[model samples]
Target: MPASPREEDVLTARELYRFYRAGEEETLALRGVSLRVRRGETVAVVGPSGSGKSTLLGCLAGLDEPSGGEVRVDGVRISHRPETERARLRALHIGVLLQTRNLLPHLSVRDNVRLPQRAAGRKPVTSARELLAQVGLGERMDALPRQLSGGELARAGLAVSLANSPAVLLADEPTGELDGETERMVLAMLRDRAAQGCAVLIVTHSAEVVRSADRVIALEDGRTTAATAPAGGAVPAEVSDATG
Candidate 1:
């Protein structure tokens, strides 16, 4: 099937700041970070361990509230919405693949992929099968998480994330645990998602992942300071000061 037309701005964060307080100390995780992502585009967020990459993704996915500024997803102000409303919006519009696999140990691969649909109260799309096929796991639909290799489990996680046909896909270290070949396969799947009109945002420390992105944004000490456009669509260099 042909992909939808690219939307101008599928996700945006303006003057975003996040802070956490521990007794007498207050720590700032994200400092005045602002970004925009268009539909059918892949953007990579690279930073060190404390640079706030995950915090930014959390805010963008409406999984956490920002201390200040705003996050808009599909033109809806996610930062201002009530928790229940924001969660509903996320269920309807966003898919996230964290660094850790979140599949249920007791569920088969196919059932795990279908979990998101059940949560969202939405019907599953036939594309779920195609997604599994794309990830090279078409034959493992009946396997349990423990029955699959690390790579196969990752592929299943990817397929599950797509169950909602989400407008925005936020992935954190989607290939962190894979071998070189498996990483390539996972990156290919992510690129295809962007090509299919989903705004793809990935947080990673991998040079390969950075290179695959359409644009690369670097974070330093919780601040965004550098961005590089793709060079003839080639993978770019590792540009962030953050390690993970």
Candidate 2:
């Protein structure tokens, strides 16, 4: 049986709504969307383009405020707070990996991973070197973002995202640009993090990502349509064990 929400849920959103207005036009990007990601689970959010996937991720991560509703991380309210407060909460509990990549071109891989630790003003649960090593980039820690190849850059970005040992990891189209093999590798690493007790949520259209997730949530026309197990179920044991 699944764990109780009160015991294992690390990320929660209820009745989320997002609206944008310009002059006489009003657009609703998200309409009363809600979901939960439990500790040590991998959830994939899948939907067609313009179906509010990005908006949902933004609100969940506290990067964008919902027009009406609430978001909580580790049982603390994150939405409706002032930007500074929201940022503080995000730094402490949320790690976001965007499709465009989350690294700074000018910073070395190690420094990029350390940035969130500095912002949180707390000791990292894992050191920068350890994170890079876990992602198979130990020798590339001193390399700049621009110097790394595609797969290396992706893993480096992931290391940065995991630096603070966030309770929830929100990834937007995390493997959109990777080749099939690399995508599998990255998904394996993400699952490894989940195994270590971090709730991981990925927004993507990738079939591989959906297959790797423990559960799949589908969105359509700005609201949740259904929640189901992946067509192929969870990642295979072989894939899950390739995190190194």
Candidate 3:
């Protein structure tokens, strides 16, 4: 895929490679990943555990730097930027939903969502109330994180992720551990974001997420094994290795 300028693409990765090194040993987590996610599209990265799903997300989110290749989010080259700079861009243009560290237990839903916007260093931050309502948590905005049920907490986390009207959204197993109702709500919110022109990328095993995606990229053993693009999908490539 061509890594064009940001006029059309919200996210782009060109020939990405990531490797971990130890004494006399090395592991390649990603090998030559190249793709593009345009505005208003949801792309799902699906594979078994340890197939470099999290690593891919980290690289895309600028939480980790790739050993080779480039990544751009909303026109910013973040693949190898300093952590501080990356965090700055992430605050302004990215919304992240992960299984861990998504919410602060001591904070109310409203406050939790506000925190990131406060640090985002941007004016006209997203409205907490509007965001909460969009996720069907308007009535629970003032409730503390620990005071909510599992489903409510999930919705709350999503509201927090969208606190800044991010241009690109990154999620890791966003529907995991949620009840049926909560899962549907989350999925709908994700699709809605895409419709609103926010590029959404998720690493997931959930059937619902796969179904919701405009495209699906499957990885195995740290390399892309197969990919189903949105337009004129191609046959899945070959597979390799034992586990992810």
Candidate 4:
């Protein structure tokens, strides 16, 4: 049976498993991992390389399917669905930030952000331009992915992920490539979003991210454990400019 998420839970995953078959050999990537992220909360998943953090994020975002169990966003099942259905659900309720950065090489930053809004097939509650501005990318809205700096790319990707004002945000190594200052700036933006009631779940290796989270889940050998109890307190400060 599917685990029943609480009314406040915006993102939930239960008993997740993933298997990869390479000819005669099979590899298990996840082993019955389960988690919950409630509205206005931030949770961080931390683990070493090959520990299934990316796999978990992929499953949560509906970009990949679980071999067992399910994922739900806003109370709707996203696992075991058709690709089109998963895509629609993801666009409607989930914002995902990929490690490589979610941008098309040829598209301008504006269009990259616009793509998710178009995919949702609804008039955007917040315009793409406004999102870019919020990330301090207003001046680079017309720039291509290759034209921006590392910090700019991160901010642009964030804008694209937030295009639909989703109920949940799933980020994989969101600030993995930035300097300390730039990473802080990006994290503050993520904190700001969580403050506005988006359930934020980050798969990360950064101690700073883990420190900023309201709770931490540690994954090892495809299993999960509560690494720390919830440290609820005031939200972080507003995001500052990071044009580098």
Which residue pairs in candidate 2 have backbone atoms (N, alpha carbon, C) closer than 3 angstroms, thus clashing?
none
Please provide TM-scores, in order, for all candidate models, with all chains considered together: 0.89, 0.92, 0.90, 0.92
Q: Is candidate 3 or candidate 4 better by TM-score?
A: 4
Which tens-of-lDDT digit does each residue in 1-244 have in candidate 2?
Answer: 2223466788988888999999999989999888899999999887777889999999999989999989989999999999999998999999998767599999999999988889999888799999999999999999998899999988998888888999999999888888878888889989998999999999887777878788888888889887888767653222222221
Cα-based lDDT for every prediction: 0.82, 0.86, 0.83, 0.86
* Candidate 4 global CA lDDT score: 0.86
**Model 1 residue-pair collision total:** 5
Flag the better candidate by TM-score, 1 or 3: 3
Off by over 4 Å in 4: 1-3, 230-244
Model 4 lDDT tens row, 129-204: 8999999988999999999998899899899889999999999888877889888988999999999999999887
Q: Evaluate candidate 3 by giving its C-alpha RMSD to the native, one decimal.
A: 3.7
RMSD to truth, every model: 4.6, 4.7, 3.7, 4.9
Give me the runs in candidate 3 sitting further than 4 Å from their true place: 2-6, 229-244
In angstroms, the error of model 2 at 201 is 0.7
- What are the per-residue Cα lDDT tens digits for candidate 3 across 1-244? 5545557799999889999999989999999888788899999888877889899999998889999999898878887878899988888889999865799988889999989888887663558888899888899888988898888888888888899999999998887787666788889988988999999998887766676688888988878766686344432332221111
Give residue 189's error in model 1 in angstroms: 0.7
